[model samples]
Target: NIINARLRGKPGLFRVALNGERIAAIVPQTDVVAPAKGNDLDAGQNLVVAPFVEPHIHLDATLTAGEPKWNMSGTLFEGIERWSERKEITTHDDIKTRAKKTIGMLVDHGIQHVRTHVDVTDPKLTALKAMVEVRDEVRELIDLQIVAFPQEGIESYANGRALMTEAVAIGADVVGGIPHFENTRDQGVSSVKFLMDLAERTGCLVDVHCDETDDPQSRFLEVLAEEARVRGMGARVTASHTVAMGSYDNAY
Candidate 1:
């Protein structure tokens, strides 16, 4: 129970009740209430509300803005290049320590849920494995969803499809793809279809970097939408960083 909590759209201090981890009720404190005792806390008229959610983040690549070199151009490709160089020196403890420290900061700000994209392009699957362990280590603090993301082109990288399949097989909760980076349009469409089919087979959620590009001709998002519609997986689908839609000839 929390006494003297100031909730939004309400007048005066309110007594907030809790059942386990959830808020049970809230009653106005019209009269002077005694100081909280036992497990209860006194809010001291401070605003009290629900926890926050971090919808999308790259926890695998956190706290490494400039390791070997800086992204002076600040382009997505340049950032990816920096990450590739950093991946060479990535260790399991390194990933977990950085991820845990970052999560601690996020939890301090009231975030209780997070979805992170872990790059799975490495042949050894180092980051994906480390993130899986971190997910279990911090289960009590927050709900962590790890995405098996292919930062490099799925069809362009060596044994790319196989690496993605192995990542999901290990412990990835969501299947991810970056279709716009493929060498050709046909390859992009093929990559999207392969990932959707893999998600359907594995019963995992789908979150694709559908068109992370500015080319107006990039149309991989259409393939993703069609696959989701055909598979009846709309609710389980997420398209992230789809910048190409903004460059379409007639678009919103």
Candidate 2:
């Protein structure tokens, strides 16, 4: 009864050995045990290796489809607007159900860790509360980190900042901001500063959706980078969707 077996040495010319069972020895080429009389066991050259990490992803919006309507504009802003409409109808049960299903999908795909951003712009904090429950429920299968994401602008939407703080109070693992979505440039920059302060106060990681636009003038990423550097929270800060970086001019 061979418990485990692995090939060692050069490809197509390696020694196969079995261990952790009755037979636990490395045999020479000639001494190698052949398959049963008629059974065939092909020794393939290539080997499969396990993954190291799952990196980042959004679990809250994973499986949501056609709630109020579809995003016909195909732009990120339109997606946000569409999501806002859908979010208005979001309930604790709705979020919990989708989150559990999304987590199951991640586990099946071999993802062991995930950093999910749950929108907290709603006053009810439905998604944030549901994610906390899902995180604890699936702790054994997948490691989950929840971000208190202000999908709507922190200052553009009424009571947005308060909702973000409430999410952190309810056990969100990170603080997130959408600076580019702010109504004005100054407000956009200010939102970044405010989110950083919130993270510091709540002792959470900072992840922002900065400069996710195609416009070349979008520069909130620099603001975020500078804020992260000044606060000594560079390592704990992550700037997502910095698409504007592609169009940044070197002269400035």
Query: Which is the leading candidate under lDDT?
Result: 1
Q: How close is each model in CA RMSD to the real structure?
A: 1.6, 5.8
- For 94-173, candidate 1 gives per-residue lDDT tens digits of 99999999999999999999999999999999999999999999999999998999999789999999999999999999
Worst 10 residues of 2 by lDDT: 1-10
Q: Which residue window of length 10 is worst by lDDT in model 1?
A: 31-40
Off by over 4 Å in 1: 31-35
lDDT of 2 by residue, 132-197 (tens): 999999998877899888888799989988888888889998999998889999999999999999
Off by over 4 Å in 2: 1-54
C-alpha positional error of residue 130 in candidate 1 after TM-score superposition, expressed in Å: 0.8
- Model 2 TM-score on a 0 to 1 scale: 0.81
- Give lDDT for model 2: 0.79
Cα-based lDDT for every prediction = 0.91, 0.79
